[model samples]
Target chain A: MKTVDARGFSCPEPVLRTRNALKTLPAGEELEVLVETVTSRENVRRFALTQKCEVSFDETEDGFRLIIRKP
Target chain B: MSDRFTRFFASRWGIVLTGAVIGLLASLLQKAGNPPNMGICVACFERDIAGALGLHRAAVVQYIRPEIIAFVLGSTLAALFFREFKPRAGSAPIVRFILGVFAMIGALAFLGCPWRALLRLAGGDLNAIVGLAGLVIGITIGVWFLKQGYTLGRSYPVPASVGWIMPVLMVGLLLLLLFQPQFSEGGAIFFSESGPGSLHAAVWISLGAGLIIGFLAQRTRFCTMGSIRDVILMGDTHLISGVGALVVIAFIVNLIFGQVHFGFAAQPVAHSNHLWNFLGMVLAGLAFALAGGCPGRQLFLSGEGDGDSAVFVLGMITGAAFSHNFSLAGSPDKLVDGALVVGGISTYGQAAVILGILVCLVLGFTLRERFE
Candidate 1:
């Protein structure tokens, strides 16, 4: 799994980061996004899901870990 | 790696504190004669700026607001210091401009922006509830559009000189203010002798306040619309917390200062119609979300050389002109203070906001985005 840490970034910035990283995902590969705010986490997940990727997440101690898979 | 206050001010706590300070300052500005609860309304100030420039002939709302001029100049200085000034534009300029126009129309109908709405509520006005609800719904609709793959395209970098235009114009406007060509002797500028337009903080004080606020807000990336958008779109409360502090602190300060006179009846510069206030902000909120920032944020962006934002700012001023010219703005009852008008929504104002919302939605849904 490839990881992209966006914990300190704000909205739209984090979403933009996840968007850029999503471009590199090959079919069947997974990307995990780390974000501190619920808004960022959900936005990243939304972006991934909208891209036809499968998405899930875990609310961790620090924040959230969103796992996305390109279909 | 810094002083205690510096460290705190730069952190999340700093942003909240900044908002609280802003809230208190707004109340104080009001007490010092800034037209009731309108100490810092970007939309209203811009409108007044427009009237001052003779962009419109509205007798009551004409004055070159030093605060707005200072907002741009101060932001420019801050951007220069931080080396964040890079001029950019061409992100659907025409569309952004149109969005700006409708945003003003909606705000005029509601008689306040998000900031004023919050202040009105703090002063014990119940009417802001509908407007607040309208803002949330509007942003929520924008979120729906976002979910459907809506995009305004991306902004690309332009020559750095391009970004200098807005700041330079701001300087010119400031010089114009100091020299204040006389409208009395048929001087080229318009000056309101009375009404909200006549009411203002001393020029230097307002200018200083504007500069401070512009610098701080630019540094903090503070925005009310962004706060609500973040919440509705992503459940983000980071920005919302700052606004929460603003309201709370303002409420407290208003109480201490004896500015808190709550109720649905005759709140400062506010009308009683709940429905129009709600629908009006819905239009404004949708327009703000679609344009990617609020009026103040747009000014900050313009200060940093974003031509797109500058164009939007111009659009808002033009829209303000049209609103007053066409009687599409709110006014108080016939026997009210100035009696010239304010606070109640006009029929045309209602029509304008509805049209604004419909047109913005069409623009939103029609712009197809590539999901693949």
Candidate 2:
């Protein structure tokens, strides 16, 4: 699993970071992203779906943790 | 409902007052140093910025405008202070982007946005009157769509950090301006060597004026499209009255400052293509209507942390690039392709307006609650 910390980033940053993380990860590996904003969670989820990845999300105190598995 | 109009203005006087102040300051900026008929144009300035960032190669209109930077920052401060700052998105982001693109294309075709269009008319550019008419017509069409169920969708809550994208970009640009980093020979910051882009007030003055205007506009909700929209839709003249006040005041100020020159032939940074001016503004007005606000209003909304508005703004910047790159934008020298592009775009806009109205009518009849 590759974790990308994007908790404080805004708008496109979280998505951009997630894309970068996915790039470095091998196929079928999990990429976990920590994002603070609800928008980012939704965006990441949407992006994961578009990229044909499976996503499991859990809410934390400050934000949310999103794990995406590349297919 | 009666009080809604009154309350809107009461709460929004800040927008009106700031809009007027911006107008006055823009005039002053022009008088002092900026280009003629372009004291502070949001679309034009953004186009310059896009060029500065190497988005397009429009040599004649490229310069980084500080007023734009100040607008976002000032609005950000105001929103933060008022606790109205909410960063949200996902209201059909792609659609908003497309609207922004069309909006820029229309504005450039008309040679101005609604604010500048009005100012252009006030300054005796008769072409602007045509543009204004087209704007009104376009808004009327948009209102029809509103009467329908044509919404961009809903915005859900986003992280506070999501709102900082444009602000951070602005800061980065300001840093570039301050540092003047070595990029290329001949000051390739994409500044216009000798055109409309070359004309500008000093950076500090422009930024200061923009900040003040942004602060005031955020408070007033002063929107050119909304002014007409309210008056036509509900017979509420509050916003329209403020708009009228702006025109009269601007004219008076122009006269006092010896800026009101009569005749249209040699007007600064404008052309005498009356038909195209009308058509161009028609496209702009329709795009603004579909997008739900004028360019200035979009900027203010973005400042208040509206992601949908921000999307529209980015769309416009991209549209500016497209227009220039595709030769769809006009210039004082002559119309691009000499009337063909104008006619084609005008037809497309009109068709879109007609289609939009038809859709609205259908939705209005079908989607009503029918609470008889």
Clashes of each: 6, 3
Judged by lDDT, which candidate is best? 1
lDDT of 2 by residue, B68-182 (tens): 8888888787667755576766666776787778778777776788888777766767777778887888777666655543455446668877777767777898887667565
Query: Which residue runs of candidate 1 sit more than 4 Å off their true CA positions?
Result: A1-71, B1-10, B183-187, B333-343
Clashing pairs in 1: A39-B234, B124-B262, B182-B187, B331-B342, B331-B344, B332-B342
Q: What C-alpha lDDT values do all the predictions have? A: 0.80, 0.71
Q: Which ten residues in a row have the lowest lDDT in candidate 2 chain B?
A: B363-372
Measured with C-alpha atoms, the lDDT of residue B69 in candidate 1 is: 90
Model 1 chain B worst lDDT window (10 residues): B1-10
**Candidate 1 residue lDDT tens string, B33-143:** 788878788999989988988888888899989888988888898777765676777778898899999999999888888888888888888888888999999988887
